[model samples]
Target: EPEVTQTPSHQVTQMGQEVILRCVPISNHLYFYWYRQILGQKVEFLVSFYNNEISEKSEIFDDQFSVERPDGSNFTLKIRSTKLEDSAMYFCASSRTGRTGELFFGEGSRLTVL
Candidate 1:
């Protein structure tokens, strides 16, 4: 079966530092998305990419954040500056179709900022 894979399952960083979270989605999947959940908060959508461009994004995805598909095989999210409030569990997901279809999610990449 195909599944999403994330690297550095857990990351610790200091405020004002930068972090790049990496993910590899299912090979045949077309839609990719990044979401995050603060320690005790609800999961929030960050951004969605398709066809080598951003398809959708939430207010949480500000100038400090950016995403890329460097090699067509891996998708990455870069946070230019980390903040204490940025600590959260980030999830990578993909689906054969768009939002109307089922999504497969990676375990999660936990980010901790001090």
Candidate 2:
């Protein structure tokens, strides 16, 4: 079965640096989302994108963050300036439809801000 794939499973960066996390979502899926999990916290939705525009975004998706589907198969999240609080597992997810809310998550891009 097809699955979402993420790059650089782990990243160590200094606070205030920029980082671009990459993902290739399932080919036929439509809805895309980004979520993060801080070390002992529940998964928090960051943003959702569809049809070249943002569908939903949480407060966590502040000015420091942006997302793009630079290509037909690749989706990317760019952090303009990272912070210590940004250290977490950033998961790229996709769903066939929103009705089921079934998200298939990539292993994750672990961002470590020091």
lDDT of each: 0.94, 0.94
Compared with the true structure, the alpha-carbon lDDT of candidate 1 equals: 0.94
Residue lDDT tens for model 2, 30-77: 999999999989999999998888999999999999999999999999
RMSD values, in order shown: 0.9, 0.7
Considering only N, C-alpha and C atoms within 3 Å, which residue pairs clash in candidate 2? none
What's model 2's TM-score? 0.97
TM-score of candidate 1 relative to the true fold = 0.96
lDDT of 1 at 17: 99
Residues 13-114 of candidate 1 have per-residue lDDT tens digits of 999999999999999999999999988889899999999999999999999999999997999999988999999999999988885558889999999999
Stretch of 10 with least lDDT, candidate 2: 94-103
